[model samples]
Target chain A: MNDNNSMAYAQSDTAQNESAQSSPVQNNSIYAQSSPVQDSPSYTNMPLLQLNDLCKRYPGMGSYMSVFHMNLIIPRGRIIGLLGPNGCGKTTLIKMINGLLTPTSGSVLINGMAPCPATKKVISYLPERTYLDNGMKVSQMVSYFADFYEDFSTEKAYGMLGALGISSDARLKTLSKGTKEKVQLILVMSRQADLFILDEPIAGVDPAARDYILRTIITNYNPGSTILLSTHLISDIENILDDVIFMKNGSLMLYTSVDSIRSQMGKSVDTYFREVYAC
Target chain B: MLGKLLKYEWRGLRFPFLVMMIVLASTTVLTCSVIYTINPNYNEAIPWYSSMALMFSIFLYYFGLIGCSIGLSLIIVIRFYNTCYTDQGYLTHTLPVTTRQILHAKLIAAFVADVLMVLAIAISLFLIIQVTLHHILSFIPEFTYADLMWEISRGIGEFEEIFGIRIGLYFAYLAIYSLIGTIANIVTLFGCVSLGQLYAKHRIIGAILAYFIVQFILQVLAYFASLPMYARMLGTSYNSDFSFFGLMSPTMNLMLFFSVALAVFMYFANMHMLTKRLNLE
Candidate 1:
């Protein structure tokens, strides 16, 4: 497994370098210059998300921050993995990006504008937990999404639901946990959004379901859109990721390409993660 | 977007509200039928069973009427909390709509619900009174619908003459007051809940506390506002040159003005919390 991954990363490394050289503009944004992925010119221009000096602190913690000053930029069309241990501020970062939580300081820009109704229109998010009303049927939920999001595709959502053998008339509460996750994923992926933020999508699911979820994500995402995926199970999603961001103790530890990590560190991302964050 | 939001908000509350309305209507019909059948005459001796039945039907009618009114308001408040603050908030907050739009949609739906509740109660009471009056007058043999109409109009004319104000204008003022009060109530609850979210723990308890605090503040304001009217009435009594309407109108208008101001303040406060200070768990 290690040998196979090394060879794959080696090939991807070459591809990344070639693409970097071919791309014309350089990302001179503050975050891009600070990130380890800065050398990759393919992601230089027109970032989809940029966070400047973002911070979140809880009261009574006496200056202890949950997410300290962080600067980062996510370019379009890249599937980036946000990998960190529990309570390492991965969820906090995602929440800020989705405008679920207000930052203590600094700003987050999506497509060069602050997170607002316009940004929300283009960002598709699937939270880790089930956030749907249980009394609603699958069909009702589809209509709800269609009503709220202009870009939602009812046909695609229904098609996926039918393919999964899930009845549209079934109440959301009656579905199994795995099936519920699938349904939520389907709702999110059905949107023709410019950015997709999935927080711990594969966590707590069986291996079979995990594989299916990953496949669904890979296939359904718009080709030019960016996917910012956060998960603890790094090995399960490492192969699909274009770049990897490592966070710890409320600060970004590293932000680089997955291929760069494997090629330079001489090991799989999962192994390097263990070595770097080992107790 | 606001229209769509309101459509869904009404859809979610329709089930409970419809159930309440149906139950109230049924009770009203049953009560009227019983009253018509009994047709009790005060001069004549009435049977024990008939009196008991009349009392029971009246109780049920009132219970349904009052229950439905309070129940609908409570349902609206709970729905607001559950949809906007709970886990479901993930979907709600992420919608491609501004916080102000969401707030407006809820307030509009709640206002419509309040209006519908008042209409239902009014219609049900009117039906009961009309049926009972018709049945009682059947014994007179000379009474007709025309006589009832004449009597109602005469009563209105007498009231206008005594008060020096049109009866219709009084009712219009009353309706405005009721609508403003309803908006104030809903917005105050929204503001309290928004304030509660500022707490790091026991948020619901915090919300309850906020509600009590708001109610206390409003009560104090109301008492102080009525003090001038109270003092004037006390010093002059009913024999003063100032008419009763002169004394009461100013107080009534002041209260309505205060309520409208409170509603506006609570609205902007709620909006601020939702957009700026929101920290959903």
Candidate 2:
């Protein structure tokens, strides 16, 4: 709540310099042509996202930091996994990144600027819960997205609905829970944003749906955009991730490449997560 | 963006409002028809059940007319709470619009909706009164609407002579007072809903408690604001020279100032909560 001194908006140069030191992906070969993680450190190549000394706390929780002083630097075109245990501030981090919650301290710079409406235009977010009104139809939601986001593709949204056999004309309440999740995912994936923050996107769906959802996410996102996904089901999304971030107690424990985790420890990301977050 | 937000907000509300208006209009017509059928020439008492049914219908009609205004306020408050502080808030807050735009849109929509409800109520009341008075006055031979008009105007003219002010000006003051008061009440409700987010759990209960606390504070402020007016009236009463107008302007000004101040305060408080302390589950 101390926004006056708690947060600062650094120029895009500040993010460029910090990103050069801590690019999420150490190697760019994973998605050879897609990610420009190896771009030169300059204003033109400013990181897609940055967090500097970010902190968030609930006043009623007696100084409990939901997201403590954590810093992150994400370059464009990489899919990063944000893995954390329960109450480890994964959603809190995502909420701040999407400007749903103001940071108690520090800064969240998207494309080197603060999280404003301008930044929001480039970030497509799928929250952990269903955010659509059940009274509306799937088609109405598609229309709403198209109305708000210039980059939204109504044609792609309807095509995905058709593929899933979900009638866009049906009211959301008339659909099953899994179908609603798919509808949300389709709407989010249809956007041509610079960053896609998907929080537990696959948690509510069947395993079959999870694979399709992940695939849809991988294929639908424009190459220039970065997908910062947070989920506990690390195995489901491990393969698609170019980089991985582990958080604990509201702090960043590690930020490195999926290749590094597999090569250095000879363990899959899921197995490593099991060991790191074991209670 | 503000326009877009308002457009969707109205679209979301249009169905419920339409249903309410249809119900209200149907009730008004039924009440007038029932009144129209009452026998103005009957000298003997009617059956107890029949009389009771007629009285009950009229009572229900007036009750509904009053409820429409209150219902609109409740509807807006609940909508504000649900869309801004519930699961739906995830989409609301993430929209590519500033918090100020969102709050202003909500406030404007609520204000406009309530104004429409008040207008509906006013029209319904006028219709009901005209119908009921028609039945009552039918018994009087050669009594006309012009006669009723003159009666009311004469009373207003006498009051104006004593008050030394135009009756029209007095009504204007009352209208402005009401409009400002409505804005203030709606903003306070929004502020209470925002305050509910302070609770880590049980936000609805927090909102209910905040509403009671706010109402109590407003009541206390209102009482204090009226003290000077009461003193002026009380002093004039002892001299036997009291004019109601002596109380009108000062009371109107005091209440108007308090309402404007309250509205401005709560507007800022709600915006601050949305921007800095929003809690969504």
Model 1 CA deviation exceeding 4 Å by range: A1-45, B142-145
Candidate 1 on A15-77: residue-level lDDT in tens?
Answer: 212332222211212223334345445464556888877878766667666776677777777
Candidate 2 lDDT by residue in tens digits, A11-110 = 2123222332243321322322222234423325467787888888877777667776776678877888999888878999999998888899999999
The candidate 2 chain B region of ten consecutive residues with least summed lDDT is B240-249
In the predicted model 1, the residue pairs found to clash are none
lDDT of each: 0.81, 0.80
- Give chain A TM for each model in order: 0.85, 0.85
How far out, in Å, is residue A91 in model 2? 0.7
Deviation of model 2 at A267, angstroms:
2.1
What DockQ, on C-alphas, does every prediction get? Answer: 0.65, 0.69
- The runs of at least 3 residues in candidate 2 whose Cα sits more than 4 Å from the true structure, single-residue gaps closed, are A1-45, B240-242
